[model samples]
Target: MMADNLMQSPENWTESQVSTWLRTLCVKEQYIKKLFEEEVNGLVLLTLDEDSLMTKIGMKFGPTHMIIQKRNELFNSKQNSQQNAKPTRSKKTKLQQKNNSKSLHCLASSEVPSGQVHARDKCASEESQTPQQPCILTSKENCKPRPFDQEGIDLIYVKHRVLQPESGAFDLISPCHEFKSFAIAAELDRTRLQAKFAKEVLKFATGCMNIRSNGTIHFGVMDSKEDTGYVHGEVVGIPVKDKDIYVDALDDIEKCFSTDKEHARHCVRPPRFIEVMDRESTAKNYVVEVDIVPSVYILKGKVHAVLLPNFNEAANKVQYEKKAILRRVGSKTEPVSDSDLSDFFQRVKERDAQREEAEKTLVLSTPFCQDLGRKLTMLITSGKKFIENDKWFIFITNKFKPDDLSNIEWLLNMKILSVFDFDPDSKISGLCSKYLEHHAANMHSLQSYSKSSDRSIKGFTEKLHLFEQTSWLFCNGRSGFKANETPCDEMTWIKTRMTLLMVYVSLICKHILPKGSLQVIFLLTSPVEKPLLHTFYGFFTEMQGHTDIICICESETNFQRWQSFAEEICGTETVNNFSVVGMKMSHINATMQMIQPVKACAKKHLPVFVKGTCLLETNREEHMASLEILTVAKKHLPVFVKGTCLLETNREEHMASLEILTVNHCDDTSKDFINEEKANIEQQFYRGGRVTWMNFWLAEHKYVGEVIERDAYQDVSKLLMDVLKFPL
Candidate 1:
């Protein structure tokens, strides 16, 4: 009724006054000046009502309400000013005023009764001098009133009764910028401001068990892609009917989370649902935000589509149809790809393999174990020979538990040690234990001797120790030891003597060289000694010998048998020997020496026979005592010797200049003796293929005839005739 009585012409109002009025109406500041300019130029009119103002100027609901209140106050004040005095107007304003008045009169005549209009005018005139306050009170309570303006207009507070104020208006609300993990929906029913989708939203919300990290999802504000995953989606504003509607929205959202099956198990704290108003806008609208407590573990399952805004296909324009699994990728939430999942699985597999390998590694905790490990590494890296010798060295591993064998396979495969891990419960186990004890004993003895800095250990005790160490190999016989009560059986005595000799050699050489470098010789007398020979062969072969092995046999059969055994065990065929001796071989001193140091005889182990032949007369004394036969064949001599012999045409001085003697084949059987001089040198007197004149040259020296035979000359002469058969 008051709006009908009030009238106003805004043409005379200054831009600043209009701007101040528009600001109170909550119109944006930038738009107020623009609107004012257009209004003054007649392109726009200020007479429009609240609804029309929103449609044309795009003002929000709150601003439109304020604009309506200000308009009525402006017309009321105009009425008070009109009764006092009328202001002069320009021609443009006057014309505009006439058109506006006609429009107003037409509206009043058709819409209102004459009596009501007159009464309204009377009331307006009476109250004109006394400015009336604008009543913005609801039926429940009258608002706090402000004083009237000088123009008899009420100064109502433009901002009144905010239905949903800023988020700060709520006491228990979380900060706007703070991240609280939860699911939030701005409007369940935008018009009614009800959380209609609350139940559905809660299902997709990363539950306390699933929410491994701090984050949030909010709806209602403008869906901003610019918001870092802090607030997943945007909410422009959700229109609410009133504050009560907002309370209902909160209740709906909170109840859904409270009823969730996973929420209680995963959530550390009770989920909170609160009403947060859009501070960026002045509308009676708010966001229904629910904060769900996070869990330490990630939910490794599918999430409901309705809970995720991006997955809501009907409402959202997302790539995924009904469901989308969104994961945090750095600062953004993105879907996981199949390739990434596969790569993650691959990494997990690799990690498991590495863990297994680490568990299997040998633990070098003790000093002995550490030292052994270092030595094994060195041996494996050195070459095959060291590793082969140490293979049987598994005897040292008697102390190793059965479980240690499992981890030791890796070391064995790397050739760090040789081992035959057959039955752990076999008789070999006892042997291994004995070997270990022996090894420890030897190592301890060596260490003790070193520490004492003494070389005076008695040879007899050493020899006794050596015998006792090997006595375990025999069944009952103390091979080389003699006792008065067990007075000498012949075989036992020989066995005992041989055993003693073997130990003696080993002990004496122990100081001068490593056991592997010494060459061992054993006398072969009888067939029963073969087994004993085998035992000795195995022991020495395991030590890795540096030189040829020797065996003095009393019979050819024994020698051949020994040679066969040597070839089988040592993988070599080269063997030489002296004539069999029937005399007691034990009388000879069992000496050990390097063969290259002794020089006495010339015996070449050449390929003279069709298959195999020994270098005859290898014994130094035997070779010198026997007759010397100079046998030469085609290509048999060295190139240097052949070169010198081929130049022996005038052999008088040159033949004597040569260190090696030569023999000439005599075909003529001549009885003439030639004395060659420089003036009359008879080089053709003795002409034949290069050979040694054994008998003819023997006549020159009395002792030489004893060593060279006449048959040796004939044999050479015939060998030369056969060589000349091939055409030169």
Candidate 2:
């Protein structure tokens, strides 16, 4: 017989023929060589037992069992072929025999006898087999129609039937399968069907929702262990009779997830049920492919959770439902710890803050008004000139509406009186009056000016000199006034001098000096006391709406004090609009020369300043109340105040005894006192009193009737009223 024919009937094969068959089976080379060297032919292979293979051929159990399995398959095929050659007696019998033949062919092609072959071996055999001819197996009365199309059934076979090497089969849970985005379950628990299945679905769904991904669960697929100790999936499939029960159970399990009315539509999508055929079995068995799609409306900073039903003793009825939060860590779904949840909230808060900051920066970068830009340019040019000339100058621009003629008339009349002492007959005063009465009817006409004669300009300059001398006297505390303690008369006189100086500069610019836009430039040649500095700050603050102001300080101490005061009054955002430059008198010329080019370029763009909308009185009252409360809590606590409110108050004698540090004293002794006070305050707040006491006091005082009724110093009024009702 030919070798190929002999291979079909393995009992008739020679020793070399047996070796060829073993090679095709992919048995290890060493085992093949050993079997061949032993002179074992097909007859000997069929008779060989596991012990004989191990003892005689020195084969391992895996190879030994594989050889035995192949030997039995060949023997069975030979016996079946011998029986098929028998002649039939009748036509009816022949037809029945033909039907049996087709069924056998299908059984051999698709199904494997239980425990006879491994999944890998079956896969290899299928790959080598020719395309199957159409058979009448589907026409059998016992076979049920497949629920899904052939393509979907084939897909399930390709993904779930092909067991990954690293995955554990027949295990309760496998990380390797989860890592691939799918899990296998043999069947639902009979004892606690709904509760058990709901738990598994919630865990997987929560993990998928938290990580923003999708996954799948393959039910009715059995994972089995091989003789080689490797585990893999086997598609035994769910029986057709129990299919409805499993489908209904999955639907009920999906309802266990928690969802609000707002998020009901956006909750996790219902898992899709796809019925696939059991490729390894001929029985009408199906595997349900549960496709899990995570929630699409997941919100930032929110952690997803599921409500798992807790069952009673019999496991039939749910007693209650408990919330559980889970997140995916690699292939495993783990319960989130308290610390991790807190950290997640913190990260979300920080991200929100950063986003808001970025938005604010974008808003501030938008182009400002064109009119503002022009005014800013003029201010810069005038400021540069004043710095170069080392002179005090004030430029006033009309900001009043054209229809607001009454306020305009009052402002101009006040300016004339402060400058010329109400001498309406004076030439310059008469000129201002004439302009206000007729030419200043509208804002555009008010900007127009006629050049003043030399006599008027000279007179304005001499008056400026007198005002300059008076300012020096007030600043230096001369004329019998103590430093930083100016009398009301001296303060009024100093303000009058400031008004005269502004008028003098305005006249000079219209006639002889270079003309520019609204700006106030003050060159402080000597150190002014704190009260006088406050006066200057107030004056400039009032004019801020009409002009851009700059203060050049000859003393570094005065500049720092001015900046601190501006921030305290106007807040940091508004303070930035007012430029305060401190430089030594000797280096003033050089500094101005170096910055002139940069300043000239900067004039093209206007700087944006967001004014604080908060009222100053409310802020000051709050600050004062907080200070007093702290002082009362910690007796003998020294407090500092910018104004003389606490010093003048007789209502609280205890507050008067407290050392009041004034801002005017910048000497080392005052600095030491301030530092000591800061340390004492810090310690008192931290370790001296119970925080609950202060909190209760503030909360009780926040809505005091007197404070609500009062327009100014509401916080201070609230504190004083509540102090009487305070629980000592």
Which model scores highest in TM-score? 2
Off by over 4 Å in 2: 1-160, 163-191, 221-236, 240-244, 250-255, 261-267, 271-280, 295-301, 310-316, 319-321, 346-728
Cα lDDT of model 2 by residue, 1-728, tens digit: 54464546666677888887777666767888888888888767766776698768876545565566555555655555566775452333332343334322222212233333454365577325423333333211111112211232212221123333323211112122331111212222443555555556656656655544444444444333221121234333453445455445545444555554233224333333333332222334455554443333334345566776555766667654667677666556777787798775556544434434433443323333223222222344554432232333442221122232222221221111112111112122322344444322211111112224555755754544432321111221122222223223434534434444344335543543432333354444333333334444544545544244555443454444445444444554554454434333323332232224332211111122442122223335456664532111111111221111112223344566654443222222354554455444434544644333323332344421221232344887788889967734
lDDT for 724 in candidate 1 is 75
For candidate 1, which ten residues in a row score worst on lDDT?
587-596
TM-score of 1: 0.20
* lDDT score, candidate 2, position 397: 20
Instruction: Indicate the TM-score of model 2.
Output: 0.24
Q: When superposed on Cα atoms, how far off is each prediction in RMSD?
A: 43.1, 35.2
Taken over the whole model, the C-alpha lDDT of each candidate is 0.34, 0.41
Point out the worst 10-residue segment of candidate 2 by lDDT: 634-643
Q: What TM-scores do the predictions have? A: 0.20, 0.24
